[model samples]
Each structure stands twice: as C-alpha cells, then as structure tokens.
Target: MGEVRVVAVDVGSVRTGSFAWAAVDVPAGGPGLCGYGSDPASAVASAAEALAAGRRAVLALEAPMSVPVPQEWEQLGKGRAGEGNRAWSASAGAGALGTGLVQGAWMLSELGRAVPGLTVTTQAGRWTGGDARLLLVEAFVSGAGKPVATVLGQHAADAEAAARAVADRLGGEAGTDVVCAPHRAFNLLAAQAMWAGLEIGADELETDVLVVRARPVST
Candidate 1:
C-alpha cells in the first residue's frame, strides 16, 4: 500500500471564482495544493497529477452524486435516509447539486480522457493502496460546515474541509452508512461519464457511494 491523495472540489458555477479545489497527499501530511478556479478542468488536472505510479487518488466532489429516490415516488421532496438535517434538495443544496451535475460529469469524463488506466470506484473500502486507482466520493460539508478556521474564503475553506474529511476516512475513520438505493439515479455522476464514453465497471443497483462526512468539532 503506497500513498493516497485526496482531492476535494467545492462545486459551484462555471464562472470565475465560483469553483475551488483542494488536494492533500496523505503521508506527506497537511493540505498539499489548493486553489479556486472558474472551471472543473483545473481540478481534473490536479486529480490527474495526483494519479502517479503506485499511488491512489480520491476525488471528492461537494455535490449530490446520487439522488436517493424514496419508495413513495411522491415523497421525492424528502432527503436521503441518513441525511438528517441536511437534505440534498434543500435551497442551497439543490442549487449546488443542479449546477454540479454537468460539472461533475464533465470532470469525470475529463479524468477518463486524461488517464486511460484510471480505475474509478465509488467504494472507499476498495481503495486499498499499492496500485494506481481513482476513487470517487460525495463530500458532505453541510450541517454548519466542518469545524475548521476559515482560510482564503468560504469556498477554499470548504474545499480544504472536504479534503480533510476524506483524508480522515482513508485513515480509518468511521464512514456514513447512507445508501444510494437502486434507482435510475444510482451512480448518477458515473452514469453520465459512461454516456460520454468512459468505461464504467458495471452499473450495479445497490452499489457503494463514498459519502465522506466532515469531522465533528466539539463545542
């Protein structure tokens, strides 16, 4: 098992200063490289750069990677089972999710285009290091955000926060048991990537979605 790098992108509009990303190379320690960008290309490039030989890269997107459709179709207005206080379709979340849909897909497509051998997996447990692989995750930075001092601004701080959350998970932290459930929306982001020609490892109904939650801060 070699080093694992985690890159988290705080998804926003396509306009300048809207999109921001942070990357942390585990074992090397703290936040490695982070910046704000106008597009997802820069973030994609960062992930590609992190995918070195004998290393694994985890790409965390602060967006709704999967929409859990309730058993009662009319109950679509509710959130996922474990999403207690923070619902994906809430005011702010809804906006971010809608905007991130295309950007996330584009980022995945670009990653596939950039790295031919990029083995993308939604399961974090399968992220055993040693070989070059890419793990995709949905970053949950909601619920008053992570307990971290703001840096640069909210966007950059959020990016770093998400990165730290993912890093902690890879370091053996307990994970959220949120299920993406079997639906047309399962693996939503990856499905778009597949439609764009990326070779997906099989569209399973009940697959794992790495929902990396930020560390709790004690009051």
Candidate 2:
C-alpha cells in the first residue's frame, strides 16, 4: 500500500481561504475536497476520516492571522459616548469584531496544537465565489506549484486548468480515482457570507470555522 495524498482547506474571511495536502497509500492523487465547514475542527475531523478510509496520508491546514482590538472594549462595559455616540458605537462594534477575529485565530491555533500529524498553511488573497467544483480545482492547482495564468479573468477556467496541473503533479488518476467528501453545508453558507463582505466575529462565531485538518486512528 502506498501513502495517500490529501489536501484540506479552511476558507478565510477576507482572503481566498486556507489549504493543506498530503499523500497516503489510500489514494495517490492531487487531492479532493473532503469536507467544507465553518470551523477548522470539523473540516479536519472529516478529512481525517477520509484519510483513514484510504491508507497512509499527508495532512495540511490553513494558518491563522492576528488582528488587533482595543483593550478597554474587550474588558466589558467601559466607555461611553457624547454627541458622537453613533460614531462611538460603530467604533466599539468594529473593535468587538476585531476581538472576535483575534479569538477565532487563537482557536484555530489551539485546534492545530491539539491535533498531531497535521500540516497547516494559509492562502494570501480573496477568491471570488462561485461553484464549489471550480474552487476545488483552483485549490488543487495552487497547491501543486503550477502557475495560475490569471485569477481575475476566466476564474472557472483558470481553476480547472490548475486542477489539471495539480493532477499531473500527483501522477495519479486525475479525477476518477480521487474520492472527495461533499462540502459541509454550514461551510458553504459561511464561505458565501465571507464573499459577501461579512466580518467573522469571534464571540458569535463557532469554533469549527478555524479547523483545517484531522486524521482519525484506524479501528
């Protein structure tokens, strides 16, 4: 049996999203979209299940980013506004949002720490939303070290090309042999919200949003 190669992803808020891949004997292909969800924990857990079903496998994840927030706001009820109360409220809201973002990042870090044998990485930019198939392809190609001709135009076509390139790099059956779990529904909505300019706050958001990889021990 050979090692299975797999790629796991954690979609970013403003950025494209995070992704990771590995090779295991279970399957030797570029990678497939195992599971998509808001939190990294669930995503990783699902990916791990996929890997176990196969054989030896490699794992990857997205790295977390840190954004700053005001300490006074984080404390609790601290500040009040006068004439510009609306502006103050907006500022406070932003700060609260920033704090949540920071917390999510921290949670992501913690998830990674708790899980062993997981490889983690981050994507730098925003990926325009569309069909999941296209995004999967784009992620594969991007991970395989192929040049993405143009991210702006022909987004779907470019992503497909990248997917093919990644398949070539993996040296396995391009699309057929590779098995992928469906993207989790919550993740789909979250990804859409992110694309729509929604800020993923910490306190209100779930922890699963940050998870990127997981591998379950064989029974």
Candidate 3:
C-alpha cells in the first residue's frame, strides 16, 4: 500500500506554521517533522510541494477551543497571580471575563474563513492534559537555563526565556524526536517559530516564517 502522510498547522493572525510527515512502509512510529512555514499560503504551498515529493498526506490542525472560555483564562491565570488578577479584573470590569473561549472560537472561525479546509483544535481540544504554558515552560527549561520563571511576571523575560528554552529543547535528540513524532507537532512547530522570531528580534506584531515539508498520501 502507499504511504499515509499527515499535516498539522498552528495558525496565527499574522504568521502561520505547519508540519507534515509520512507513515507508510514504516513501523507504527510517530509522524516525521516534514516542514514548517510562516503564512497559511506559504504553509499550504510547502505542504503541496512535500506531497509532490512523498506518497500521501492528511492534515490535522489544532482546534480553536473546546472547553469553556473563562476556564481557559483561569488556566492562563494560574502561576500568573498579578497579571491573572489584572486580566480577571479587566474582564470583570468589561463584563467579559468568561468570553475568552468564545473569543478563541471566534478567532478560529475567522481563521477558517481565511484558510479553507483548515481544521481548528486547542490544547484542551486534543485531550492533551496539562496547561499549554507548562508544556512550553518545560520545553524551555529542558533546552535553556534555569533562569527566573516568567510565569510570576516579566513579558520580555518570558519571551526571551521561552525562546532560549525552545531552541535548547530543539537542539538535542529528544527535542527532534518529539517534534518528529508527537501528535501535537503543530504546537511544537509554532513554539519553534515563535522562538526563531524572538531570536531575530522580530516585533511581536510582525509575522514570521516557518518552513514545513509536505508528503503525498492515497485518497
């Protein structure tokens, strides 16, 4: 039988990153990190090119949100006592505290509008337990230093620290293995793209590029 390939995307307002892999004629192992990219157009283009090179492919994207919106904010609030409290207050002040999930859903809807055939999923939507930030923090810690934990406070520090952490994590065998095989490869690739942008001093608002590989699959 021909190979079955898969593609995953992590989309953002300005930049979008994707990853793809083939699982044909191979063991029941993880998916490969075929490629990544910045914009949806480029990411889709790259994936097509990869499909041209490989056997067959399927696409999986992170869902926008499955859980309640306020719950997600509460999740982000943990360990961020001050900012969390502030965000909570702002939400209360604006009477929009519980709309985070709705916002995420809306964003996902808008993104889907922009990219047809794109699917949306969230960390919770994937049934992947634990906070997304924690995963990011763990990745950063494994790759970089034991600097001050940014969850307490410090946006720039957190960004730098996370970037270094992601770089370090991706620098070794384990890191590569995770990105190549994990189900949530899109999140990892997105984290890497964010780290790269940080390294290049890209503005927070500026879109960044991520290169991904595409593989072919039987329909």
Of the candidates shown, which would achieve the greatest lDDT relative to the real structure? 1
Every candidate's CA RMSD? 3.0, 17.6, 16.0
TM-score of 3: 0.26
Ranking by lDDT: 1, 2, 3
Candidate 2 local lDDT, 108-134, one digit each (tens) = 344334444333221111111111101
lDDT (C-alpha, whole model) for all candidates? 0.71, 0.30, 0.27
Each candidate structure's TM-score, on Cα atoms with residue i matched to residue i, is 0.84, 0.27, 0.26
Q: Is candidate 1 or candidate 3 better by TM-score?
A: 1
Q: How close to the true structure is residue 171 of candidate 1, measured as C-alpha lDDT?
A: 73
lDDT by residue for model 3 (8-56), tens: 3332234111211111111144233344433345444543443455433
Best by TM-score: 1
Stretches off by above 4 angstroms in model 1 are 28-38, 52-54, 129-132, 147-151, 180-185, 205-208
Better model by TM-score, 2 or 3? 2
Q: Give candidate 3 misplaced runs (Cα > 4 Å).
A: 15-30, 65-219
What's the CA RMSD of model 3 in angstroms? 16.0
- lDDT for model 1: 0.71
